[model samples]
Target: MKKHNYSAGPCILPQEVFEKSAEAILNFNNSGLSILEISHRSKDFVAVMDEARALALDLLGLTGKGYQALFLAGGASLEFLMVPYNLMKENGKAAYLDSGTWASAAIKEAKFFGETVVVASSKEQNYNHVPKGYEVPADANYFHCTSNNTIFGTQMKEFPNLDMPIVCDMSSDIFSRVLDFSKFDIIYAGAQKNMGPAGTTLVVIKEEILGKNGKTIPSMLDYAKHIKAESMYNTPPVFPVYASLLTLQWLKKLGGIPAIEKINNAKATLLYTEIDRNPLFKGAAAVEDRSNMNATFLLNDEAHTPIFDALWKEAGISGLPGHRSVGGYRASMYNALPIESVQVLVDVMKDLEKKVSKTRL
Candidate 1:
């Protein structure tokens, strides 16, 4: 049975990306050297790195607009600190919008550097809705937010128009939709979600936003230093970078972000429509704030859990289980997830409804 992967991170990638990556792993660039053994500074690897950076900006429509892209070793978790370290000035405060677990985590890291004021939060309702009507102070060094909440299945569909700089953790839905990338001063994402494997994180920083933090930052955490070295400050995640390059190449061939956004919307609509129509299940997040990337839902009646479980499992569905914090199902529909997989899940839901109907009769 073909597995329909819905795992949140380190999740499904394009089949062609996988095949090409596999070949490169064995003999990268037909150079007879395993990609695993290739040097990060090698000419071939350098080209891969360059292309990956270029493709990321091109997809976001930020190329040559004073924004620089970097592929770094630490995941988005590291960026949680690096963002504040490089941007948050000493005694200067930052505004954070708390929508989910990862957003809260980013807030925590920001507090370590300087003052971090949570302008608004949806935590009062278990992060089921995105916060709205928040006031961002102009004195803040930057306004930081997580563009999508993977754990709670919420996403910020409408971004705030802030006079201050805007920084975001787009880890879950970076390339899944179209956005005005110019509005963001910094955008960071872990590749595991929508880009590639789990070893690299993509960071796009507007060049002028650096060097204002006032504190001496470690070289590795300094965004300006990384930009100076062209993200070759230290040995990078070579294999993961190569794989990301292939994935980006595939995305370009598929006509870039605009094309993928349409497909992603279709996938999300299919899954969410089932969640709403199925009497057996209910959505976890607020309808307005519901994420197109991760759909969290639960069986309305826990007694039917076994039947529903069997239906999806027998249909070869994986990673539909929700986070421990939210005891339900979370179907993460990233850029690479096919609408057919969503149809399978929806069909299972409908089947469960039919079975229940006949049982009641």
Candidate 2:
């Protein structure tokens, strides 16, 4: 049976990337040495690291002047604390936008390091929408936000233009669209989602923003330490970093972010359109606030879930079940997901519609 992957994180990757990456794992660049066995300090591996960082900057349209890209070990979750640790001072407080689970977690971590002021939050509405019209503190260290919430399927449609440095967690939708990197002081994402396999996190930071906090930070949690060491302060996640490099190569070949954004939009539109039009299903998020990456929806009759699940399984569709927190179906349409996969899902929904009509008659 043909399989369509819709798993959220550590999600589906390009077949070509998997194929090439697999070959490298066995023997990288025909060196007769597996990529896993090579020394990270080796000249060959150094080139891989350099290319990966370069591709990230290139795809994000970040010129070398102010931005420095680093591939680190801990995921963006670590960055939650690191952002405040490096940016927030002894008396400094940071502003955070609480949109969903990840945003709240970030806020929690920031509080451990320093005072964190929640500038806006959608928790009152169960994170169904993005909070709007909140005042950002002028004296805050930096303002942090999650660009897209994977579980809730809501996105910050518009970013606030603020005088303070902007920090964003783009873990779920980093390269899924075109972004102005200059507007952000720092941006970080776990490689598992749109980038590559897990075990590595990508960070793009403004060079001038580091070392401002007088409080000493653990070397591992310090961005300046990772930057000076070129992300080799300690042993890095070589395999995941290499896989991310391949994904970046794939992204570049597909005409960079501009081309990928169109395809992403088309895929999301296909699934969301099906959900909106189908009587059996309804979208979970507000129309304007819907995420282009993770599309969350629910069955009209909750009891019909099992039937819907069985039908999709028979049709070779998988991983459409929503998160427990949301309790429905979530189809994660990341950049690597082909349009045809989404069409297959739409077809499944249409089939279910037919089945329901027949039973009613």
Candidate 3:
């Protein structure tokens, strides 16, 4: 049986994406060559790269808006280092918001470049909520924030209005909803989440945001250089990019972000409603800031853990355990996760409640 996948990343992808990616792996473009063996510079792979980049921008409504989308290696972790290197001057400062583990990791990277100021943080609250009413220093070179906290299950409902450039790490929730894509000068996400599998990280940057930092950025670390190379700065992650293109094509066929957003909202509502209505479980994050992509919850009584765990597993659920920092259960409802899967989990929850009630009798 195909289990209901709730793994946070390298997570679920469309069934069709799996089917198509597998075919390409064996016989890409029917070229009689495995996707793995093709040259990155080959016309076939170059067209794949070009379409993926364009489709990404087109979906985000960033096409012809002065933004160039690059599918590069090194994941979001590399972007952590590169963002500061290209945007922050030696003495210049940058502002960040700390909401979860990934955000904290980024803050650490930014500090290596120059003065890093944290505008506000919810660390004292164990990141159960996104920080609000915080101030971004106007003098800072740019303001950076993470759009979603995968581990903590919190998402930013709104972003800070800034005078300078705005950058966001949308790693865990990119392409899962509709947003004003043009509001930020730079947006980056690791493709492992909503976009595709691991290996390539997508960076959509407004071309005008490059340069003027006055810092000598190394070749690979420079956004302008990567854009000039048309994201072929070196051999790209060919297979991941191709798979991501398949997923994007699947998404487009499903009617783009506006279409998927409706389905995503429905799935989140179904699970969250059950969490709130069922006496056995409770949500881990603030209701106002709860993430539509990842929903973290816990049983009301820890002693009931084993029974609850067995019930879900028997019901074909997988990857429901929460992060180590937040021990409970996390239902990661990415773009490809169907609502039927969520209904199954809800049924299991109800079944568990009935079983426990009978035990008390």
Q: Which residue pairs of candidate 3 clash?
A: none
Task: Give lDDT tens digits, candidate 2, residues 129-210.
Answer: 8898999999998999999999999988889999988999999999998877689999999999899999999999998988
Error of 2 at 325 (Å): 0.5
Candidate that would win on TM-score: 3
* Clash totals, every prediction: 0, 0, 0
Q: What TM-score goes with each of the models?
A: 0.99, 0.98, 0.99
Off by over 4 Å in 2: none
Give the TM-score (vs. native) of candidate 2. 0.98
Give RMSD to native, each candidate: 0.8, 0.9, 0.6
Error of 1 at 241 (Å): 0.6
Ranking, lDDT, top scorer first: 3, 1, 2
> By lDDT, is 2 or 3 better?
3
Best candidate according to lDDT: 3
Tens-place lDDT per residue, model 3, 1-361, is 7699999998999999999989998999889999999999999999999999999999999999999999999999999999999899769999999999999999999998899999999999999999999888879999999999999999999997788999999999899889998899999999999988999999999999789899888999999999999999999999999999999999999999999999999999999999999999999999999999999999999999999999889888999999999999999999999999999999999998999999999
Residue 285, candidate 1: how far off, in angstroms? 0.6
